[model samples]
Target: MHVQNKKRFYLMVGLLIVVILLVGFSIYMIWSDISSSNAPVQTASNTTNTANADSSQGNRTDITASQAITNPTDLLVLVNKTTSLDENYQPSDLVWVDLPGVRETQLRKEAATALEDLFAAAELKNLSLYCCSGYRSYQTQEELYAENVKTYGQKEADLVSAKPGQSEHQTGLAMDVTAESVNFDLLESFGQTTEGEFIKNNAHLYGFIIRYPEDKTAITGYAYEPWHLRYVGKDVAAEIDKNNLTFEEYLKTS
Candidate 1:
């Protein structure tokens, strides 16, 4: 009887030892799995932060060059010196007749010449283009703003016209072109026309670009104006056109 009791006690001890070993192994495996699951999340967070830092570093590198001026105030001066546009928002008073007999004034001689070259290159075909607006003086801009406010109210007018000195037209680097058939109305439908497409594809060759492209309204501070072209000169315009960038982006890169 004593031998049988001892045997039973030994059997119970063996069973308890086996259960403890199984429980410990299970706990260890669970801990390892949890640790493994967290590794990918940690790696992803590190990668995201690293990518943002690299992008910021690249932007800083672009600005570090002596010739590359990124600040709008400094860039305005650089662009004015580099191009034919008037400095300090002064526009030329000379008005020239364009291809379709539209009398238009340009801010500079270079702007007129560039337009003439572009017009000559255009096939025209059945399409006739007219220059509606070119340069604007401080007074002219104020008058336009007043008129817009009367017609569209203050808020709406502000969107369509710049506040006097802030306008690109005041610098004489920009122009407004339109289809003669449409009476120079700026519209997206014009972009679908062959003449529009031609201008879109070839304007960069003559140192011009569509100032407010459809995709870049947020950056340009204006709605899409297919007719508005800004002259930054051939080299810069070509780069902007080729890279599919806004003047703001081009300014940053410069």
Candidate 2:
């Protein structure tokens, strides 16, 4: 019948319209995803955006984690969120430290000697810098990270604690120092005290530099840890201090 055929024609047209709409939607979704994938990813840090400076070009550098250090024992080896030491790479020249109330008191022999000189120099200046921590193992760092994750959520814990193999303490060339002025605590307030000032000004003379400076969190990938000192030999330390450069910057030029 003509009327029956007319109804069937309308039904087919409606189904065809629905099919076209679904096909168009699928194409739009695929195109949107492809465009999004081409966009540059922003590396957001907890405190601020990690800056990638290129003074020569006077523009933001393309920041990326450099290749892992070939020799972890290199005196000036750089380690950070980007640069990581191997889990099995422990320093061969570690020596026990007898500093007061310090845990994990072992450092490379050369660094240990420099630390003693630094502490002695502080004492002569009537400032007491107490070494708190040094030389963490991969397992120890893993435990620390898990504990932090429990206390704070994973996002917060990532900001506060380094993941295993990502900590500089594993290198035996970094030390955390505190003073009685801050109740022997590793507090940012320590950086403002006379003792912290002495270390800040005098540490490079003893082959060490403040690993994280107050203004360098964007470059250092962590909050300012004024108590953390990394030994890179006095010449390199002095250069880093004089230029006001982060270890990341120093590595690029050095």
Candidate 3:
């Protein structure tokens, strides 16, 4: 009887040890799971990246976020990534463009007249230039920018598209031009076509300038858009072209 009791006590001790081991393992597993659950999970869409000016573009002006632009109606008003026009701002003199285009668009009366002359001059040279886009509203720009972000991701979209209220098109002075040689699409290769070269050389004669030049992408915060023209009046446009300055640079020194 004594031997049997001792045997039972030993068995109980072993079973208790096993139970304690199992409990400890479960506690450790729970703690590990809790730690993993608390950790951060980074995703492509959630990652934040602040945009910095390209060093090659020269020292970028540190603009206050959502800075108010008071000269929204000025022909040379500056709009960019930092500065923004009012969401409700629309040009009072907006007029439908009579020039050939991919879609119906409008620009300020003065800019519309300038664009007409530019197109007519191109026609004289047998260089068929078509308006791709012009005079975007804040809402339209928002939707367009959202679409771009969905398609290209935020980082890439920022490089190619402007946020709402930050676009120059909102001022009714900017136009995106294209040609049949490139299927009437906005493309960098359009800069190499005959129409592109003609516009680059002579657009200023009609009160426009290649707003974003090939070599000034850094300063402009945009890619080389030879097709994008901004009407800044004949004198300002001529000075900008002659000095080989982007509109941003011209504004700084002027």
Candidate 4:
């Protein structure tokens, strides 16, 4: 009877040890699974923080597409204005003939003064920048269009010159500038000379922008014209330049 009781006690002891071991293994497995799940979350959070820091450090300017144009009214002015032949078309017309003045007509008086300053600056370097075309009239635009169609065919002429009433030149805020030897021939000399590059790069400082840049041909509906500068004020020009957007793209976002 004593041996049987001892045997029974030993059996109970072994079962208790086995149950404890199983409980311990289950606890360890649950802990390990929880730790593994938490590790990925921690890594993901660190990666996100690093990416945000890197983006902030890389760019000082707010160059998002929405920041390109601040004024919505400016776009309305550009689209509502009529273009003239003398200002943007071939066989230039007289400056004061049109009822609605060209973009130069409405430009801040300071703009003209700035042109004078620009000329003076250019003179120092023996680089002559002259305004070949400033403002144009609707009648002048019509005549120019007729002539273009006669000379270059409708399709070819349309590529270079806008039809009457559809031009940006009528705003009196645009100008066609040319170097001394290449006067009025801005179309042929874009990106070829130092003067062209200078105007293209620095025109924004004076509240002017290349109306039709090379990369934005599709948007502007015209080929690149390095010498054509549109005045939209200094702040707007700076934003446009920084964002690298065409006027059309700026309009869409704004």
Q: How accurate locally, in lDDT, is each candidate?
A: 0.68, 0.81, 0.84, 0.60
The best-first sequence of candidates by lDDT reads 3, 2, 1, 4
Sorting all predicted structures by TM-score, with the top scorer first, yields 3, 2, 1, 4
| Candidate 2 local lDDT, residue 40 | 82
Best by lDDT: 3
RMSD, one per candidate, in order: 17.3, 15.9, 16.5, 15.6
Residue-level lDDT of model 3, residues 175-254, one tens digit each, is 99999999999999999999999999999999898988997767888878888898888888898889998877777676
Off by over 4 Å in 4: 1-76, 80-110
Q: What tens-digit string does per-residue lDDT give for candidate 2 at 164-224?
A: 9999999999999988789888888888999889988999999899998988877887888
Error of 4 at 89 (Å): 18
Clashes of each: 0, 0, 0, 7
Q: Which predicted model would earn the best TM-score?
A: 3
Instruction: Write down the TM-score of every candidate.
Output: 0.62, 0.72, 0.73, 0.58
lDDT of 4 by residue, 29-60 (tens): 99999989878454487789976754443122
The reply for model 1, stretches above 4 Å from the true place, is 1-89, 92-101, 124-126
Better of 3 and 4 by lDDT: 3
Query: RMSD in Å for candidate 1, one decimal?
Result: 17.3
Instruction: Determine which window of 10 residues in candidate 1 has minimal summed lDDT.
Output: 72-81
- Residue 126's lDDT in candidate 1: 49
